[model samples]
Target: MGPRFQNDDRVRLYREMYEQHGPIAPVVLPGDVPCWLVLGYRELHRITSDSALFSRDSGLWNQWPNIPADWPLLPMVGKQPSILYTVGERHHRRSALVSDALAAVDPFELRDRSERFADQLIDRLCGRGSADLIADYAKELPALVLAQLYGFSDQAGAELVPGINALVDGGPDALRGRDRVQAAMSGLLTSRREAPAAGVASRMLHHDYSSDFSFQEILEDMMVNFVAGHQPTADWIGNSLRLMLTDDRFAASLSGGRHSVAEAMNEVLWEDTPSQNIAGRWATRDTQLAGRHIAAGDLLMLSFAAANADPQVRPDRTSFTGGNSAFLSFGHGDHRCPYPAQDIAEGIARTGIEVLLDRLPDVELAVSAHALVWRSSPFLRGLASLPVRFTPTPTSAAGVYR
Candidate 1:
């Protein structure tokens, strides 16, 4: 049986193990499932790449009656089988759809939209002297962008934010929130089917798949995409902003105007990686990894957080700067995350940051940096709250984007 540890202790132990052991370590999960936590850069790459040896299907979790069946919010966003969770030819086809959508969209247009969103947010918070960065800025920005892409009305988009938060946080409250979000999404899916709009949901609805995706399948896809799309981006923005504020060198990099804020943002994604712990995978056959013996049917967890810090892969790894390209926050190989298109999302996120920095270069943290609370979840990583103080920028004469 797996040794029991408090959530806090487990997280601490995981971090310590990474520091002490290099990469792979033994982890005792609930129910005593003997598992190997892959923390090394190369090991993570190997484990995620060998689809034949590892399975993404939640067969083990699905069989557990106590766990919520509707836990994963993937099925409701698109018709594709969440490229991150499937294997073989199906995975290929699903990935192609996501790639094609990103490729079809104009990059400059997306960046402009991001800049406008950032301008509006800064207008609201700048000079206000105090704001909860998570609520006032980070959370809302990504939710709005995703909503716009999905053709949701502002009101509908607003309604879903709390629900998304609950789902990502995961607990008793999360179950309740999931129910609310699922219902809302179900209704929206039905309405869209009746009156399709020219957005992502509409595109998914009209996708010319060889096999027709069922209504439930479409709903599942939406859930995954919506939750994945917003939560992590929100976490990234909040965390990156906090880091930049605290680290003079990183902040200077942004304000110096020499290294474009865009490059700095890429460094953030590569370094911080909001999705700290990816979902568990089951091994199909005994496999050797990092000289450890593996048994078939054992569980394996990938720690992107740990991998991003590995010195072998990210040679210059540091807290503020370094370890950019080596970070595999997004899983590698066939099951890599397909949304927010790194190029597009990074551009959009950076454009927003650039606008904010341009307007409020002196913005600083309202609360002590150490006082900020880190959110706890086995699946995600981010701030629970970020209180910041800054002078508000004057509202642009231009109207907000509809």
Candidate 2:
């Protein structure tokens, strides 16, 4: 599902998997959980498109009887009341509610917030002449911005960052992190219900389909939305910066070439997407996919990184994929990340990168690009740290962001 080794090249790993298994192949998860890994671009698109055949409901999984209580994949594959597992008419309404709430976010305000948070992060390190971009800037920026949009005050948002990071890492702290985030969400919803102020939470509560969804259901959706928004956007920012700093094609970006920033960001989506794989769809009935026989209730893990690099669509894997947005970095069809949500993510990532380059024009790697390590997770892909050095400069004199 992901790079086995911290230093393993993911692109090479995906290539090897595709060459050996073609489009679809069987693979084992951490607990020896068997599932189909959909690696072909066309195959993945078909699975997402036909939700009636491949349902999002984890309850349909045939492996549930064997899954243990302590299993690590439970958090992902577990049957919850969130929109991820919702089906038919209800799921459609829930998706619209979320999309509309996120769509209501002002683009100008979003960009302003992104730039403000980015500058605040860079200001802390600009005078040091060196910093780990992943920890200091990339990882912190998304959550802070998202917290505000999700209806939390600045102090409350700052407090939620550690829990959000821990939750995504899926480490031992994951449970506690989940609790922390849940508690904060619960509080936010309670307050928004009372005051009905601005932000996604408030909007969701007041939507036309608001009554169609229970309070618990809305809370679950907020949890899903918050986690989904934070980590991947953070990874996108980090991965794009890593590409621009390391690849010769983007060398001009580090030297004040603004246009290359967008090019580098787009290239990262195709080549080094953050949301690499998904826990995925469960079969509703027996069906054949890519010549493989599927039993009813069988699980299918989406290999988005593999699908994006599928040789069928991308015959020339080495060539630049300039301005092409056809990549499956975000899934397709019914369960795909909403368009407005995608726009919000792009705004945050692009603004963050642009602000960093504008602040530290000479920023370059402090360690060799090859020496950089990746975070080992079965789903998401991102650098562990991106240490770099640049000329020291004074911190920003603006007051702290509220």
- Per-residue lDDT of model 1, residues 224-308, tens digit only: 7777777877877776787777767676744546364645555666655678776567677777877777777666788887777
lDDT of each: 0.67, 0.90
User: In candidate 2, what are the lDDT values of residues 43-131, reduced to their tens digit?
Assistant: 99999999999999999999988899989778778888999989899999999999999999999999999888888888888888999
Question: How many clashes show up in model 2?
Answer: 0
Native-to-model Cα distance after best TM-score fit, residue 361 in candidate 1, in Å: 2.6
TM-score of each: 0.84, 0.97
Error of 1 at 85 (Å): 3.4
